[model samples]
Target chain A: MRTAIIGAGQAGRRTAELLRGLDAEREILLLGEETEPPYDRPPLSKEVLLGEERPRGLMQRAAEVYEAQRIALRLGEKVTRIDLGAARLETAAGECIAYDSLVIATGARARGLRIPGADDPRVLTLRSIADARALRARLRTGLRLVVAGAGLIGLEVAAAAIQLGCAVTVLEMGERAMARCVPEAVSARIEAWHRAAGVVLEFGCPLTAIRPQPDAIHLVTGKGEVSADLLLVAVGAIPNMELALDAGIAVDDGILTDADGRTSHPHVFAAGEVARIWQRGAGRHVRFETWQVAQHQPVAVANALCGEQKPYAELPWHWTDQYGRNVQILGTHSAALEWLEREDGGRLIYFGVDPEERVHSAVLIDNGREATPLRRIIAAEKPIQRNRLLDPSVALRQLC
Target chain B: MAWHDVAPEGEFEMDVPKVVQVGEDRVAVFRLADGFYAISDVCTHEYALLSDGFCEEGKIECPLHQACFDIRSGKALDEPAEVDLAIYPTRIDGGVVQFQL
Candidate 1:
């Protein structure tokens, strides 16, 4: 049997490796829109943008490893359409690939900035390796970098640019940074860190339009006008669900998939950043563009494809590195949950609890050490005694 | 270098990792359930101190990016870190923990 996997990012490459390991005889075709080998995505905004590291050996496997694994990797090819009934995928080059089982790991694309100067040459988005290389060359000591969003990617870029001696300003529509992902306290601390680093952070100001000139790009916002040598639109990402939608697969923001990675179609499956998976206990759809999910989700998807049915029940956990500080978050928080915070060794740790005082999420700032055990605690949804969680003497292993 | 005294026994608690200077080398001395084990304090991933991190199940997680290193083996068991840490032999001399500098 042959397996065709679409979009060769972290999820695509990982799933290919898993499928190859599971069954050697199965034909595995890994397709990617970009020709570059799969490099770690998180580092693009951190080390790579700062020019501290080169883009070498960033792949899941070396060339030799790919050759040894005998997996067919097709790069720089876009899937134009997916015919679910025929089980055929049409590529941009007019090649119709037939697969017995298909996995749509198309992942998400960067949400674009829609304004007059949004499509200007000076404007860039750091979604690919090319983008990183381009932005790295443009970043100089005196350059003014105006980041459009205050999310992880945007903030990370700001930090990298500041390190390069560039004047960085971040404009966010929301009142706080990382509004969708992290807790308010965490956001406040990060904002403070950015501000203290000489980064001009303007919250509650949304960009109205951009006007690119020969020297600098002019930005008009809710507050006032600002100019930039180059602009980065790191607002957010929207899932690449059009291909799935064309195939009549149910897509709501992302490719909707069950716990076992099976989509609406029988022989078709979805995984990675693209899959808005129905989380079992959470009773909600979750689409996480995390290293953990991309690296681990394939095991369950591959298992189910091979007739071993095991659902993906891993708790959502993510981490970010900024300003030489590490932040780790397990699960997520909404307004419904109660929050309790503790300060350990000058580090702030916040725990999100349900109405019954059951721990639902944990945010550890500059303290990623507890993330491993804390992930289990969140997954278990165990009723956390407030005093025990706050006590430093109490070992996390014992409490969980 | 021979065994150099670093800290008093009472200051080092079980499963509590601390950083101390053994001559020139910065060492992370962990008092496990059994005895004391000393490894390099600086995380192999980032420059964060392992002493400032978390410890459990014979593993010391680097506070920087959660990269876990086995206390006894000094091997990095997780991602963002692939290098192993240097381990120094230690012994309790009198009431002080002396690590080989």
Candidate 2:
């Protein structure tokens, strides 16, 4: 059997490797739009932005490993069409490839600013390796940077820029940072931390216009105009679901997938940021753009393709490191959860408890050591005592 | 190889690793449900102390990036950590824990 994976990002590479591990005799083809080999993206906003690590160091694995596994690695190949009936894909170069099974892991791209002067080369977005390299070159000491969003990417870049001795200003449309994913209490805490670290944060401010000059870039927001040497639009990402949509596969913001990562088409499957998988806990299809999900969902997809029913239903966890502080969030944020905050020494941890007294989610600020035990407690899905959980003296593992 | 006395049996906690400095090297001694085992303190994937990781079922998950390693064999079992860690032989003698490097 021949299995073909499109978009050789983390998801595609993982699917190929996992499928090869499951069936050694199966033929696999991994195609990527970029000429470079698959690499990790988490460090692009941190280590690569600070110039602490080289680009080659971000490679997912050695180039020789793909060849050694007998997996065909095709680079610079963009799939333009997918013929589901024929079980074939057509690349942009007009090359047609047939496969018994196909995976659509096209991923997503950075959303662009929709204002005047937005088309200027000075207005940048961080998405690909080239974007990181270009931003790294401009992150000089004493340079002024104005970021147009206060989301995770924007705040992370602001932190890195501040460490590089750059004057940073972050503007957000929402009242707080990461309003879509993070709770208001956690957002306020992170905002205070960033403000204390020499970052100027402007809430309720959205970019309305932009004026690029030879020396500096002028960004006009709801509050006023700010002049900076560099301007970065870190608003959000748009899923690349056109290929799947054109193939008549189901799509709603992203390619819709069942619990097994199987799409509407029997022979076609999807994973990563481009696919929204069915989440049992949420009772709906949810899309997660996290490093952990990108590395994990492929395992279920490969297993499903090999006639195994390993559902891709896992608790979503996301961690962000900024200004040398590590913050980890476990489980999905929801209104049904009542949050309770606990302080251990100097660290802060927030637990989201449902009406049934079950632990739904948690937020840990620099207390990653408790993640494992807390995860076990959440997975048990049983009623928990509030006082014991709030008490710092009681070990979290004991609750499990 | 030389055996270096690190700590007493009472100092080791179940499923917790203790870091002991042995002549310019930091070794992590883990007390599993079975017995004591020693491995290099540093993570193979990044600059982190494995002693600070979460230990369960004879496996250690790095606190930094969540890379998992077998505490007994020091074999890396997860991604982002492709290389295995160095392990050392350990023995309990007269209430003291010692490891051979």
Candidate 3:
């Protein structure tokens, strides 16, 4: 059988690797729109922005490894159309590639600002290595950076810019920063930390207009006008589901798929940020823009393609490093769960427990050691006592 | 290879890993259900200390990205970590745990 995976990001690369691993004789073709090989994305906003030199060995696997595995990598090739009836894909260069199985791992693109003057070439967003390098080149001592959104990417860039001696200001439309993912208390603490680190954060103020100049970019928000040397609109990301949608595949915000990444078509599958996977726990389709999902979810899809059906049920997790502090979150955070907190040493850990005293989610600040044990504890689905959770003497592994 | 004293055996708790700086390399000494095993303290994928990771079932999981490694062989057993860690031979000398460099 032949498998063709489009958009060779983490998800696509992993799916191709796993499929090749399962069946060595299978013909796998991995197509990436970018010229570069599949490289890690988490470091693009963190270490790449903070360090002076680009880190070495950024590729997930060397070309020799791919060659040894017989995974044909077609870089800089864009799949223009997917003809489901013909079981083939049309590339921009007028090449028709036949496939027995098709996997759409197109991922996502950085959402652009919609306000007037937003189309200026100077307005930046960080999504790819090129974007990171461009943004890093502009970060100099005494430079003014105005970030539009206070989400994870925006705050990470703000932290990096502030540490790079740039006067940074973050504007968020929501009342609390990272309100969509983290709890209010966590966002408040992060906001306070950013303020202490010389970052000016403005919440509940949406950017109304932007005017680009030779020297600076003028931004007008609901609060007032601010001029900066650079402007970054880190609003969010939009899934690249156009090909799947044009092919008549079911899609909402992203390409719809089952737990095993099976789409409406029998021969077609989807994964990564472009897939709205049907999560059993959520009781609805959910699309995650997390590195964990991109790296791990493809295993299930690959297995399902090989005739072994295993559902992807891994817990959602994401972490961010800012100003030497590490913040890790596991599972979802919502007001419906009761929040509890405890401090051990300088690390603060928060647990979101349901009314039945079951740990649903957790947020750890500088508490890396407890991550796995707490994950097991939450996965065990056993009721835990609040006192034991708050007590420092009790080991988390024992509770698991 | 020369043996170097890492820590006293009394200082180690069961199923816990202790990191010690030996020469220019950091080694993580684990006291598992069987005995003691030593491996490089750093994760192969990122800049995280594997000593801060969770050790269970003869395997250690990186705290940062959850990349798992076999403690016995220092083999990377999961995603995000493709390189295997360096494993060092360990022996109990007198009342201390010693690992070879």
* Candidate that scores best on DockQ: 3
Task: Quote the lDDT for A270 in model 3.
Answer: 96
Chain B TM-score (each prediction, in order): 0.90, 0.94, 0.93
In CAPRI terms, where does candidate 1 land? acceptable
Which CAPRI tier for candidate 3?
Answer: medium
lDDT of 2: 0.88
- Of 1 and 3, the candidate ahead on TM-score is 3
Better of 1 and 2 by DockQ: 2
Minimal lDDT window, size 10, model 1 chain A: A54-63
lDDT of 2 by residue, B1-101 (tens): 89888789998888887788877789999899999999998878756778877888999887767888998999999987888999999998899999998
TM-score of each: 0.89, 0.96, 0.97
Report clash pairs, candidate 1. none
Q: Candidate 1, residues A253-321: lDDT per residue as tens digits?
A: 998888888899989889798998888887888888887778778777888889887788887778788
lDDT per residue, candidate 1, B1-101, as tens digits? 78877789899878887777755679888888888899998877656788877788789887766778999989989665767899999898899988886
| Pairs with steric clashes in candidate 3 | none
Interface RMSDs of the predictions, in order, are 4.0, 2.7, 2.4
Steric overlap count per candidate: 0, 0, 0
Model 3, runs deviating above 4 Å = A52-59
Q: State candidate 3's TM-score.
A: 0.97
